[model samples]
Target: MSGFVLNERLEAESRLVCILGLCQLRLMNDSRWPWLLLVPRRAEAEEIYHLTPLDQTLLTFEAGETARALKRVTGCRKINVGALGNVVAQLHVHVIARNPGDAGWPGPVWGLGKAQPYDTNSADALIRAVVKEL
Candidate 1:
């Protein structure tokens, strides 16, 4: 167990779908991809280096698990998992399922276009699907 919890802004900005074993699991607001965010429960952790070795291993495991689950559900041609704290400044990893012809293909999923928000039912359905796997 960790001493930290999910950030307020992150929870407010996205829909939480499932609980990954070692992290806070959230579904991104953007509907363009089957995207998930995994944030380790480390107090005030703003970078990967802030984590203890054991926590780092836990984050890696969570990220890999998220990537595998997303791949299995979405059948994406590729999956992107990374942690860049420039914007949110939190020690979090992103797991995105990407298709070859997605909104941003052969490139990063950041800042490509306006985010297409998922419909309420769609979001619920996706969340349930992910939860079933979790």
Candidate 2:
């Protein structure tokens, strides 16, 4: 996986948080929700089926761990986990922490509204909090 590279769109939208066993954890820049992306470090792998059995298992474990960390940090009402590759084909899972009255509640967050980029201080604090759990 030395040649693994994150897609440009993902790179632009997320900040590299830390590297886990089989995936690189990224913090989404949007501040509207506690969102994280776990992208497998497999070059040219667009879907989960493209990965080996071991890699597939690792992805699931990492995603679950990430979701737990988010839950601990945010205490969100719900945690949404999915691997929708409709736009960015990379094998990445979204672990979003959702609240009852948050924007786009009772619906998907995708395309609900403009993304509110996190300010520097808040983003740093959140990174520290999430890293502590990781």
Candidate 3:
């Protein structure tokens, strides 16, 4: 467990939020969407199946809670939850809040447009709101 460390790419792309039961919750820095990443703290876990059964169950619960919180905070038209580790390969689940007219509305947010990083004030506020829900 002590060997567990956040992937550097993930660390650069997101801000640390509070930890859930089995994952370290992170707020993606892009302002284009309200997104959260749930990363299990198990070391060398590059895939969902790498987790123990209990950890896998906890990850699912954490992902659901994150999706609900994002929906309540962003009031998005829909929520997108996925675990595509093709790029980062760090076993992270993405919970994205999507609106009908949002950029790449009908598609994935990846590579849609330049990421608009959140301002400190907005980031802090959002973190507070979501953490409160969690």
> Residue 128 of model 2: what lDDT?
92
Query: How does each model score on lDDT?
Result: 0.80, 0.91, 0.90
Model 3: runs farther than 4 Å from truth?
none
Q: After superposition, how far is residue 52 of candidate 3 from its true place, in Å?
A: 1.0
Which is better, 2 or 3, measured by lDDT?
Answer: 2
lDDT of 2: 0.91
lDDT value, residue 36 of candidate 2 = 96
Q: What's the CA error at residue 82 for candidate 1, in Å?
A: 0.9
lDDT per residue for candidate 1 within 5-118, as digits (tens), equals 677767776777666656788998889888898877678898888888888888887788778878878888889988887767767788899898888788988767887889
All candidates: TM-score: 0.90, 0.96, 0.96
List candidate 2 stretches off by more than 4 Å. none
- Comparing 1 and 3 on TM-score, the stronger one: 3
Instruction: Report lDDT (Cα) of residue 132, candidate 2.
Output: 94
